[model samples]
Target: MAVGAIGVVFGDIGTSPLYALRDTFAGHHPLPLDQLHVYGIISLMFWSMMIIVTLKYVSVIMRADNKGEGGSLALLALINQHTTGNRWGKGIILLGVFATALFYGDSMITPAVSVMGAIEGVAVYQPEMHPLIVPMVVTILIGLFLIQSRGTEKVATFFGPIMLFYFATIAVLGLVSIAQMPQVISALSPHHAVEMFLADPFRGFLAMGAAVLAVTGAEALYADMGHFGRSPIRMSWLAFVLPALVLNYLGQASLLMRNPAALESPFYFLAPDWFQWPLLIIASLAAVIASQAVISGAFSVTQQAIQLGFIPRMTIKHTSTAAGQIYIPVINFALMIAVILLVLVFQRSSNLTAAYGIAVTGAMLIDNFLLAVVLFKLWHWKKPLAIGLLTMFFLIDGGYLGANLTKIPDGGWVPLLMGIAIFTLLTTWSRGRALMRQGMAEGSIPLEVFTKSAHSSATRVPGTAVFMASTVAGVPSALLHNIKHNKVLHQRVVILTVHIEDVPYVEPAERSTVKDFGNGFYRLTLRFGFLEETDVPAALRTVTMCGEAFDMMKTSFFLSRQTLIPSDKPGMALWREKLFAWMLRNAASAMEFFRLPTNRVVELGSQLKI
Candidate 1:
């Protein structure tokens, strides 16, 4: 698992040596390739990794996992469970959602930037290869996305060893360069970083923006924790990944100190001429693996968001029986388009850098905020201690965020814009769902009243009819519509309400609560962990109190399809209501999302305004 963490969890940060230092000197925010700048930037990268990745995430944040699951959403759910249920808790929830929105932006840019940075090595091999760089990156990216449908486990089995090799190779390469310019090792001192910043505050500050690239994928340590577990990821990072990355950055700095012109491409130049091509090949593979991790994270986020009701359900195809190995065609194709467009527009890795760090830094800041919440409210840490720890984290994250903000006009706006757009959609969907429930609740009838009074009033049909509802107490809008239109109720009416719990996984024993409401009516409330997929028919088989076991062929599932009409009623803005309506129009049908038997499902449409 430690080895696998090397392959999947650390890909983005591991590959940073490929362009991180190079961009510091030659990127849009260029700095002098002198010893002061070299030492300062190298020192900044080293401490950023130690402080941000090691201290904040691995030590503090990873401990905040939600039922062994880690990520912004999972963490949000966990924190939401513990915090004040007033507007303050809602505010934190919004922050977490926006962090998730930032993640989507990061997800899109990671593939484009990481892959392009790796392929740009060809330019070092031969400057004439510049024109082919974009095409090669585009081809590789398209191929990567195209193969996402076919799960990565088979290929991922070998990822650990391959990435281990890549890390070892880079470490060795760094050692060789450090040997030639041993003085570069002195840059490890915090003094150099402070001195350089003091010497030229503005340039050092701007360089801090590019230096952030070193720890770009640090969040993955938390995001991908579920895949490899906390122990493996932390062990891999502390033992191997951190050492290799630090050495490589120092080596790049050493190479620059010896010959300033090496700033053109210090990573490639650090390699012996004969080994450059092999290094490039290994680097490209690492980049693809890094991109793979981010892409998979995107899929996981989409699944979580849907289950948590932040996004509309999309067609989710489980590519493997292995837990969390799933695919969403809509998300896949959409990401592919966004990634390709980013590559085409940015053209070079240096340009992409301007857009890269903003999303990550923003996300890191949000994580710290969530972590503070966990410490005070959930972990029951002393306020002073929690405040002190949070102060330190804020200082580091705030500095990085401030640095990255300087890039907004250059290209940082790309991810910022994307984050805003996604955040809007997510908030709109959530608010709209709340308003929807409110509107539905207005006309909802209690189960006892409906069953006792209406059972005798309606014609009875054979077999069971399951009416899906948002709440267990009320008569489902679908049932109301169905009875009003058809004027009949089935012999057995199951008022089924699926409750997505805040936790990640619920035990089968605790997954359902069945109540016999009497008179051929059974109120069934199915509970699922937020991470668990919902399958109505499957869970229904567990119902012994329903008289007989459920048979898909004999049972008919009824779903309510609400046609949302833009309203002047007190709620969201007019535009947001329209946006929610559009999103609803495109969401996957309930039958598909809940894994119900398609042939046994019936849709009853009703109009609602919020």
Candidate 2:
């Protein structure tokens, strides 16, 4: 598990040595390649990881996992359970959702930056190969997305060993350079960072934007805590990943100190002539691994959003029998296009790096807000300690965000614009779904009342019928439409609703609940955690509680497909209502989403306005 965590979770931060130092010295806000700046940047990078990744994420926030799951949505789910009715709940929820939106922006930029950053090493080794960099990056990234449909289960076995070698190689390179200039190790002290800020606060502030690149994937540890437990993640970080990253940064600094001209390619210069080619190959592989992690993270986040009702359901394919190894074609295509455009427009990793800071820092800042909720309300930590911690985090996160804001015109706007667009989609879907549900429920009859009245009027059929509902209390429109049009009810009638819980996994023992409504009417509620798949047919097979057990061949599933219309409602604006309507139409079929038997499935459609 520790090795897996190193391969999957640390790939992003592990690969940062490629460009973190180079960007700080020669990025958009270029700094002097002198002793003070080099030391200052190194010190800043080290402390940033300590404060942001180690202390904040590993020690503190990982404790807020939602039933062994972690990430903004998972954390928000945990907090929402406790603060459902509080006035502050809404704000925290929005912040969490927005953080999720910014993550989409992060998802788009990571592949572009990481692949280009490593591939550019070829350009460094032979300047004649520079023009091929963009095409090579585009080809590699396209290939990566194309192969996602084939599950990573087989490939994942090798990730641990490959990443282990990569980290060990970088550490060895760092140690060799540090042996030549041991004084570079002293720059890890906090005083140099303070001195840099004291000397020129503005440059220090600007560089904060660049320094944050080193910690871009810090959230992955928390995001992937459920994949490999916290013990393994913390073990991997402190015992291995963290030290290797810090050493590589220190090595890059040492190289710059010896020859300032290495600023153009400090990372590549760390290797000897014979080793440079191998280093490039290893780094490029590492970059692809990092990109794969980001792509997988995006799919996970999208699944969570759909389960949480923040996004419309799309086609989700389980590429592997493993729990979370799923793929979403819509998300994959969107990310591929966005990432390709970013590469084409930016034309260089340095420019993409400029755009990268805002997306990550913005998400980090919002996470600070979520942590405030965790500390004050959930954990109830010591007041003084929580206050001090929150204050420091806000200042650091805010400073990074503010500094990155200055890069808006310098490619940073790419993420900000993407974040805004994605946030609108998320919030709109959430709000629009709420309004739609409320509208649909307004005139709906209760299941118990309807069952007592309607079972007698409709003719009883031979087989069993399952009608899917959004709520347990109300009758599904599909049942009404079926009874009214055909005037027939199955001998065994099941009114079913699938409820997505706030937790990550609902135990099979507590998965289903059935309430008999007398006669042939029964209400069955299937509960699933946000992270779990909504495989209805498979879940039904284990249910002995619903009499005679579920036989898919003899049972027919009925789904209500709502045709949304733009209404003159006060809940959402007219334009948003139209957007919601369009989204509803394009959403994946409930039959596909719930994994119902295609041959035994029926869809009943109804029009509604929200």
Candidate 3:
């Protein structure tokens, strides 16, 4: 598990050694290639990992996992469970959604930048081959997304040993350079970082933005907690990942002290001449592995958003028995286009550097805020201790965010724009769903009243009719339409409502509840964990209340297909309502999403204004 965690979770941070130092020294805002800056940047890089990744994420945030799952959406669900309807709680929820939105931007950048950084090494060995760098990186990214449909179950086995070898190789290379200038080891001291900051406060502060590159994938440790347990992730980081990154960063600094010319490509220069080509091949492979993690994370986040009603339902294909290993083709294709475009636009990893940290720091800042809420309100930590810990997080996270904001004009606006677009889509879907529910409820007749009034007069038919409803207490629109047009009711009527719980899994014993309404009428509420798939037929099999099990031939599923009309409602602007309508048109049908049998299903259409 530790090795697997290292491969999957730490790939982003592990690959940072390839371009992190180069960016700090030769990027958009190049730092001085002198001993002071070298030691200082090295010190800042190490401490940033300690404070942001090790202390904040590994030690504190991982404890807030939602039933072994972790990520912005999981944490958001967890926080929503603890606090609801309050102003501050709503604000936290928005921040969480925005953080998730920003992650899409990160997802696009990671593959483009990481692979480009690795491929750039080819230029060091065969400078004439530099022209192929962009094309090669694009090809690699295309291939990565192309294979997502078939799943990673087979290829995943090699990830662990390959990444382990990558880490070990970098560590050995770093140690060799560090042996030449043992003084680089002194960067472990906080005094160097402080001295560097004291030398020129603003410049050193700006350096924080670039230095953050070293720990870019810190959040993955928490995001992937479900895939590998917290203990294994922590153990991997503490015992292996963290030390290797620190040594590599320090080694780059030591090598820079000897040869400033290496600043253009310190990571590849650290390799011996004979070893550079093999190292480049290894690095390119590792970059692809790192890209795989980010791509998979995008799919997971999208699935969670759809389940939580923040986004329209997309087709989700489970490619493996592992619950965490599903694939979303839409997300995969979208990321592929964005990443390939990024490779063309940025052309080099150093150019993408300007766009990288803003999203990461923004998300980290929000994570700290959510963590504070959990610590104070949920964990019941004392005010003083909570305030103390939170204060520390604010200082670090806020500082980094402020530093990264300086890059906005250069290229950071790319992520900010992407994040805003995503946040708009999410909030729009959420608000639209709520308004649609409100409209449905406003016109809805009481279930008991409907059954009492309609059942006696309507012609009774044989077999069971299952009406899917949004609310447990109300009559489904499909049933009303059926009664109005056909003037008949099934002998056994089941008004079924599916509820998505915040938890990851609902045990079989607690999966469903049924209440008899008398006279062939019954109300059934099916509970599903957000992580669980919703299959009406499968869930119906667990319901033993009615006589005999549900037979597909005799069981008819009814679904309400809502046709939304834009209106002067107070909820959203007319433009947004139209946007929602368009989104509604594209969303997967309820029957498809719920895995209802096609031949046994009946859809009744109704118009809604919101």
List TM-score per model, in order.
0.99, 0.98, 0.99
lDDT of 3: 0.90
- lDDT digits (tens) for residues 152-173 of candidate 1: 8799898899999999999999
Cα lDDT, all candidates: 0.91, 0.91, 0.90
Q: How many backbone clashes does candidate 2 have?
A: 0
Ranking by lDDT: 2, 1, 3
lDDT of 2: 0.91
Which pairs clash in the backbone of model 3? none
Candidate 3: worst-modelled 10 consecutive residues by lDDT: 565-574
Where does the lowest 10-residue lDDT sum fall in candidate 2?
A: 563-572
- Give lDDT tens digits, candidate 3, residues 224-326: 9998999999999999988888878878888899999898899999999889988999999899999999999999889888889899988888899887789
List model 2 lDDT by residue over 1-610, tens digit each.
Answer: 9999888998888888898889988998988888888899899999999999999999999998898999999999999999988998998999999899999999999999999999999989899999999999999999999999887889988788889999999998899899899999999999999999999899999999899999999998999999999999999999998898888888888888888888878888999999999999999999999999999999999999999999999999999989889999999999999999999999999999989999899998899999998998888889999999999999999999998999999998998999899889999999988887898899899887898889789899888899998887788899999999999999999999899999989998999999888787888889999999999998988777777888889999998888876566557888888888888889999888998888999998998877
